[model samples]
Target: MDILSTVELNDCPLCLGPGLLEEEGGHCVYATCLDCGCHTVPVNYRTEAEKLDAAQRVAHLWNVGKVISEGVGE
Candidate 1:
């Protein structure tokens, strides 16, 4: 698995679906659920060095069920 895959996230709190890690333009990261459209707020970062930290924070938010129920993909 890749480094991001190793970040770890729980099943979707809303629908028990698989969680996805999304990085936007290398500026922010967030976690999203594929099934029920649940997602965590994006964590912004200033530099490439901060990407990992932001991703990890989003993953933690996702694991703890801190998410918004709107689908970004849909």
Candidate 2:
């Protein structure tokens, strides 16, 4: 599997933790992380290409932290 599928396999890409609960939001699908006790929209990916794109973006965020861990970790 690619990175996007790999990432989604673990948990929510936003929080990057366990206990991710899926919530349908109109046109978008949302998943919440339970470990950090925070909510996130994660990367907005569509098709396989989109998923890959989003996965790459999310990987950057995961490494940089600033992209997602705002007010959560410093």
Candidate 3:
């Protein structure tokens, strides 16, 4: 089974809008919001917990109004 199929994603924490999940080399990477252009950091495929942690961190930063740098997860 694909790793992505097992993961669950939430709306953009910044704008509470829809977003797209990015992938590279067949691995789940980051998520980007369609409305605000905010995105999460590229998550490593080491473990499921790590992936979720990265996503949560991104959401937390957005929630606190921190500016996420661009060109990430490219």
Candidate 4:
């Protein structure tokens, strides 16, 4: 499955505005908005359908607005 063919570059949930930078590394792919420091998890999906499902889950979680932060020491 091709990431570019499955994902929409413009409709990034993390971006929430516009101009998202899509990045792919190792076993996952995600989008990021540098201005907001917002990004999606590098979902480990083997198929295009799985990737879409994972993206939906991530978007839902982001929409819920329950952010969890951890300290370096912790």
lDDT of each: 0.84, 0.46, 0.60, 0.48
Write the residue-wise lDDT of candidate 1 on 1-74 in tens digits.
Answer: 45467688889987899999988786788999889877899999987557778888999999888999865533
Q: So what's the TM-score on candidate 1?
A: 0.83
Better of 2 and 4 by TM-score: 4
- Order of the predicted models by TM-score, top scorer first: 1, 3, 4, 2
RMSD of each: 3.8, 5.7, 5.6, 5.3
Q: How would you encode candidate 2's per-residue C-alpha lDDT over 1-74 as one tens digit per residue?
A: 53434553344445566734232332233334566644444656456566555555554444443233344465
**Runs off by more than 4 Å, candidate 1:** 71-74
RMSD (CA, Å), candidate 4 to true, equals 5.3
lDDT of prediction 3: 0.60
Highest lDDT: which candidate? 1
Residue 64 lDDT (model 4): 54
| Alpha-carbon TM-score of each model against the true structure | 0.83, 0.41, 0.50, 0.46
Q: Any residue pairs clashing in model 1, and if so which?
A: none
- lDDT value, residue 68 of candidate 1: 94
Off by over 4 Å in 4: 1-23, 66-74
Worst 10 residues of 2 by lDDT: 21-30
